[model samples]
Target: MTNFTLSDLESIVATRAAASRDESYTARLKEKGVAHVAKKLGEESVETIIALVSEDEERVISESADMLYHLLVALHLKNIPVASVLTELARRTSMTGLAEKASRTPQASGGRQED
Candidate 1:
C-alpha cells in the first residue's frame, strides 16, 4: 500500500488550485469562493454521516475522502495551513476529550476565543 500523508494531499490540492480552472476541479472550486467550498464541505459531511449510519464501510471511506478533500480546499481558500489544524489536534491530545472541551472558551462576538 502506498503511504499517503495529509501534507502530500495538501500539496496536490495546492497545485490543483494553481492550475487552469477549466482543467482542474479544485481550481474551479477555488474560483467559486470560500462559500462554495464550505457548501461542498457541508454536503460531503452529510454524505459521510449517511454512509456511517448505513454501516457501509466502503461508502464511508469514499465519502470521507471527499469530505477531507473539501475541508482541505476550504483551508486553502482561507490561506490556513493544514499544519495549524494538526497542531491544534496535537495540543488537544495532551488532555482528555472532556478536559479539552471544557477548556475552550466560547467566542464573544467575532473575536478570538480565550482558553
Candidate 2:
C-alpha cells in the first residue's frame, strides 16, 4: 500500500491552488480568501466532533480527513507551511503535556492547546 502523508497532501494543495478557480475547488477556496477558508475549517471541525461522539469510525475518519484538508488550505492561505506545524508538534513532544501547558501564557479564553 502507498503511504500517503501530510507532506503529499500539502504539495497537492499547493499545486491545485495555482489552477484556475473554475477548474479547482482548492483554487476557488483560495480566491474566497482566508476568512472563508477559516470558516470551512471550523465547519469541518464541528463535523469531526459530531462523528467522534457518535462512535462512527468511518464517519470519524472521513470528517477528520475533511478537517485536515481544510486546515491545510487555511494554513496555505496564510503562507504557513505544514512543516512549521509539524515542527511545533515535534517540539511539544519533548515535554510533558502539563509542562507544555504551563509554559504557555494564559490567553483571555484560557489558551487552547492542540498539542
Clashes of each: 0, 0
Per-candidate alpha-carbon RMSD to the true structure? 3.5, 2.5
Query: How much lDDT does each candidate structure score?
Result: 0.92, 0.92
TM-score of 1: 0.90
Worst 10 residues of 2 by lDDT: 106-115
TM-score of each: 0.90, 0.90
| lDDT tens per residue, model 2, 1-115 | 6799999999999999999998999999999999999999999999999999986899999999999999999999899999999999898889997877777776832777554
At residue 70, candidate 1 shows an lDDT of: 98
Q: Give the Cα error of residue 91 in candidate 1, in Å.
A: 0.6
Q: Which stretches of candidate 2 lie over 4 Å from their true place?
A: 107-115
lDDT of 2 at 3: 98
List pairs with backbone clashes in candidate 1.
Answer: none
For model 1, residues 1-115, the per-residue Cα lDDT tens digits are: 7799889999999999999999999999999999999999999999999999985789999999999999999999999999999998999999998788777766522356444
